[model samples]
Target: MENTKRKIIIVGGGITGLSAAFYTKKYFDERQIPIELTVIEKSPSFGGKIRTLLREDFIIERGPESFLARKMPIMTLVKELGLEDELTATNPQARTNYIVHKGKLHKMPPGLMLGIPTQLTPFMKTGLISPLGKIRAAMDLWLPKKKGMEDESLGHFIQRRLGKEVLDRITEPLLGGIYAGDTHSLSLQATFPHFSAMEKTHRSLIVGMLANKQKPAPSIAGLPEIAQKSMFLTFRNGMTTLVDRLLKELQTEHLITEQGVQTIVQEDGGYTVHLDNGQQIQADGLIMALPTQQTAKLLPNRSSIQWLERINYVSVANIALAFDEKEFTYPLDGSGFVIPRKEGRLLTACTWSSSKWLHTAPKGKVLLRCYVGRGGAEEWVQLSDEQLITAVLQELKEIMGIEAQPIFHEVTRLERSMPQYPVKHVEELRKVRADLAIHSPGVYLCGAGYEGVGIPDCIQQGKVAAEQLAAYLEL
Candidate 1:
């Protein structure tokens, strides 16, 4: 008699890990393959950056608030998980956003898409840019495209075509906020290759964007009315609702939490996972969903995957301050505002949560979501909680004239949460994956640190990893 059951383990219970586990089991079940699957998380929670807090009538997201409606991967996953009905979109009417210039907030121009000016009237009439800056930006219409496909900095690309004013006043604040990185060192090829393609196709960023604007959007027929009309979507309850649903789909007995993987030992043509809690598990296949830095630590022979350790991360913090309706002086007229690094302010950006998402607060209540720290200047993230809150409040007072104390507040500090993509990032990652295939045959790596950093990207990476693992096991 011979043992026949195969064991597969996924380290890290974040979206990537859960997705890998779910898809792997689904694949195995469809083929009637007998295998044992386990998911382990270091934290006592499942969703790594998707936690929600419910206090009284307010629902606050501690991690990612929502996903873009256009990200079809997440949309498909939501539908497959029977959560389509739970999807909700941003408030349709509260669409205005702002950018801080010289300590004052200026409404974002109407036809600005991702910091590129598409409409002429609004760009010319807007006071956000000086006359010289506006004139420089208009030169993009006649600027020559770069000569080659060589990689460049996002800052350099924007500066070269439209000028530095647009990069500082518009793109740096809006786009830089996403990666929490300085545009000067950020890679254009790895982070936003589409911009380069846009230039190639139209010879002008503005002209390319104008063409994009004229093109009719794809048919989103049969999607929920809210999802069809909105650019972003999330569950009515919160983003963590997806995490909760994924939990129910998995085997409860195999979902291990509060324990992390210590080291991995190779034996018997398979692997042994040693847990930090002084336990061991044997597995024929493994999926490493942890960050690249953590993954490098577990591998015995790390000479090949040394690049993993080179991938860098930046720390940041988000604070949600609540106020009584009458006590809050600033009108919640817009979605929020972003502050450019040149402004030299402690606050990076602020989101009027109550206005942006109607479900975030009760009627007559206000919720303001403020962010601190950026890639170039993130030392403030290590400040004490009280000190941090005080600094944010002071800035808010000057920025929004909110001198009143918040009725309640919640602060979340994420250390090394955002990954930075350097030049030639895609090629570097490809080389590492090939090295992994040759060195660790049965192990797979998929997470934000590898391919992409968005929620949909992580989920897709997980599903792809599962497919590769199943094939490796010849299932």
Candidate 2:
């Protein structure tokens, strides 16, 4: 008798699931294994939070604008899929960012890596910190190392090392903008392992950063040379391009859209997935690539479910506005600004989209995107589109002295979009994986909920999960 082909099912057709399907097909094709792959997505289209809006030669990104080039997996996949040329770097002039301090926008001093100021001269000259604050922040060099087995919050770590001014004025707004999380609840060990290692090794975060800066950086393939200069990046077209290319390359038979998975049951030696529309499919291996809350709804009750409940999520609203270039009094030079919660601002952060990426707007137009409703700011999510636009514009006018009405406006409200990596996040993930090994055998998990949240991080996680699942099935 001829051997039957093994079947693989991937739930949630986001970047992670799509990447898994693509790699699974490639792996089986290389091995000459008879394997059937199926991808189920809840939405009518794929690219779950990633959507590109093209209107009147203006490319608007409703989701993430870009991925950091330093991360290798996404760029490598881009090259493999023949999209190397479409990649565009941010404008060199827009590299610098600003922070709101005492009702004014102040340039974030250069030589600072994610709130840890490395260069002393720039750190001392910045008005974001007071003389006392500067003294407190510099005391990190002399402060003894903190020894504790318990996980520390980002707030505690920065305040201990760099003082409250650094945390409130700089670190809070920058990190809070990115994570949509309160620094007090964010875990230092899980979210940023490098910083954790720095403390463990050099006893001072600043000292470790300066020491590491002197050493040569590692080589990252397929990434653009410009990405090596910074920690973040995005495409000129939008993040959806990456997803669209992946879907295009993978065989259509292996991909499924508009199919919502309802439940999973163990069968013979594999598993059977039941769809919401009363359809069933069996697979030898399965991967659930979704947020923790979404994953919990599909799994059986266990310790992992409890951990999922413990892992909370926050909502955010991104408002994109377009205005004429002549409307602003201040020159639009820097990347944008982040508003500290202490400043009591309506918006969290704003990005100068047109300035950040060339060709994002026509020669005479300006584009900006504001982030709102992070952590305790859930009320912003419930605001009407007009209300959201008004709030963001009002804040921009107050902060940047721009009072022009937007020529075009786009609002995207994400209810529980960003996952909170609270203290003990790593421990929780380890337990979740262990539970999967016992209950949902031959299953994998990936996405922002598990690892890093950046586009590069998610791409790397997706690729890693794909390789692991393919190897498990011998495909």
lDDT, each prediction: 0.88, 0.82
Q: Which ten residues in a row have the lowest lDDT in candidate 1?
A: 219-228
Prediction RMSDs, each to the true structure: 1.8, 1.8
User: How many steric clashes between backbone atoms does each model show?
Assistant: 0, 2
Residue-by-residue lDDT tens digits, candidate 2, 5-51: 88888888877777767777777778787877888888899887888
**Model 2 residue pairs with clashes:** 66-234, 67-233
For model 2, the run of ten residues with the poorest summed lDDT: 221-230
Per the 3 Å backbone cut-off, how many clashing residue pairs does candidate 1 have?
A: 0
Candidate 1 Cα errors over 4 Å, as ranges: 1-3, 220-222, 300-304
lDDT tens per residue, model 1, 96-183: 9999999998999999999999889999998888999999999998999989878888889999988998999999998888888988
Candidate 1, residue 192: how far the Cα is off, in Å = 1.3
Per-candidate TM-score against the hidden true structure: 0.96, 0.96
